[model samples]
Target: MPTLILIAGPNGAGKTTFASEILTTDLKGVRFINADEIARGLSPFDPASVAFKAGRILLRETAELIEAGTSFALESTISGRGHASTLRKAKAAGYRIVIHFLWLSSPQESIARVRSRVKKGGHFVPSEDIRRRYPRLLHNLVHHYLPLADLWFFWDAQGSPPVGLANSMTHAISDVDRFIHDR
Candidate 1:
């Protein structure tokens, strides 16, 4: 079956690292979709300037893949309603949806990691953006994305190295909710 695996969480939550691990396994045939990668390709010197264009291109590519029943994976923060409609379309097109969500205790963790990345010359996301998206992403993860997912994995990204809480939603839902509600 065609699949759409979403590596999602707030920015700097190790979504890309997890996605890279997925790629190294049996998903070699799946098309990889990272907006930052697309933006960089559009303008290496100033990727942020063309971010919107990259998003448009990603939307187009995803639509085409859905129409063709192709398997793919993408990165998202799940902060807004941006991906809800797309997942609906993918479901309609018979794509198996999987979400691997990386969780941090707070926005402060996200800010700290992004700052570390900036020191290493990585792309920068403003701390304000991370702050606003943090709670919003968790909210959407619980109310929107979780229901659509055929399979869901939650990873606690609070440690120096993140750890998986559970591999299946059925096994993890209560714990996941508790973790979220505790904050």
Candidate 2:
């Protein structure tokens, strides 16, 4: 069966970096549907300017991949309800849904990382947007994603080399709730 992997977290929580590493390793050749990469490829101008257009194209491409029964991975903030339905469709189409979540301690960290990435010439997300998305990401993760997923992996993204928190396959952790809620 094909797998639909969601590398999700708050904005700037290192989803793209983790996705790159995993793609090079075990998930070689899986089509990665990243909006930022698409944005960069879309224009010679600033990627941030065409971000919304890239997002729309990304959504279309993702749907096409799903409809074609292709195994793929995508990065998301998981801050809204849209992905819940996407996961449902993928599941019904015989895809094994997998979630790999990267967690930061707070929105401040998200803001900091985004600022740093912007300085390094990455696309910029407004600080207000980061703040708004942080709690929503965790809330949606708990309520919308975990139950639907076939497997999951959670990571602590604070360190240079991220540490594993837990995964549904073998390393489930009890404090996952406390860890998320307390932050």
Candidate 3:
């Protein structure tokens, strides 16, 4: 079965890094997509700004990839009602999607990491900006209207996902495959 894995969290939660690790370490025959990359390269925006158009394109591309028989692993900071709508569309399209809500217990380490990345001219937005936007972002993540995922995994400040998280994630995808194949 074609599967959609959404890695989501706040600005500095290592979602992108974890997504890369999943693509490189956890599975074979997986295609990786990063929203920030698509946002920066494919969208119409000033070099310094993120484009909403690109964000929408990212979701569209994800669904299209899932429909095309490729497993998609998406890394995004998708905390909003709009994000739920987008993921729901994927579900409505007959795709099996797993949402991994990567999280840090506190933003302290996360904010520091974001600051360091920005000082190094990283793709992530600045830490100060993240700090200012965090309350709203947290609200969006916790309360936004989206379907709960078939499975969820949490990451810590040390960026350590549970030891069995990868195995469980793969199992979920495999279960979806068995279902599709049996049909």
Candidate 4:
């Protein structure tokens, strides 16, 4: 059985940075999938026009890869309605799911990060849109996505991982390994 690790959070919560660190330093040999990478090169970088399409493709590819027994790490904001269905498909495909939510210090911090990213010529989402969406993203994470995980952890991007999440990357990989062998 393969595993699907979701590293999710609001914009600029360091989802991409953290996922890259995990893949490069902590969890070697795990393939990485990110919808933002798929959405790259779209003219004008309008997430509203391209995000859902990329997300659908991401989930489809994820299910296919999991069914073929490929373990992978995925990064996304995952605030859309399709998130639950995507996770369900992965679960039904026999993938153990591990979700990590990266919480920022505050909405202001989140907005600041988004502004910085836009200034740096990264994918551009308006700061006001990110501001408006932050709370809802938190709502989805807490009420919808968190409960679906076989193992979950939350990290404050401004600081270290929370108490129960100490050494989280190693623990997450170990938990996935345990699940795969136990089945």
Which structure among the candidates has the greatest lDDT? 2
| Candidate 1 Cα misplacement greater than 4 A, ranges | 172-174
Give a tens-digit lDDT track for model 3, residues 1-183: 556777776777777777777778876567777757776686435534666666767778866775675767776666456656655666666666776656554456668777777687766565666666555555554455223455555444355552323324555544432432343
Give each model a TM-score: 0.94, 0.93, 0.70, 0.78
Clashes of 4: 0
RMSD of each: 1.5, 1.7, 8.4, 7.4
Worst 10 residues of 2 by lDDT: 170-179
Tell me which of candidates 1 and 3 scores higher on lDDT: 1
Clashes of 3: 0
Candidate 1 residue pairs in backbone clash? none
Q: Candidate 1 — number of clashing residue pairs? A: 0
lDDT for each of the candidates? 0.87, 0.88, 0.61, 0.72
Q: In angstroms, how far off is 13's CA in candidate 1?
A: 0.8
lDDT of 2 by residue, 1-183 (tens): 999999998877889999999999999999999888898998857888888999899889988989999999999998987878889999999999999989999999999999999899777899999898988888888778887889988889987777988888765434566678776
> Model 1: how large is the Cα RMSD against the reference?
1.5
Tell how far residue 130 is off in model 3, in angstroms: 1.7
Candidate 4 per-residue lDDT over residues 69-98, each given as its tens digit: 788988877666466677777888877888
**lDDT ranking, high to low:** 2, 1, 4, 3
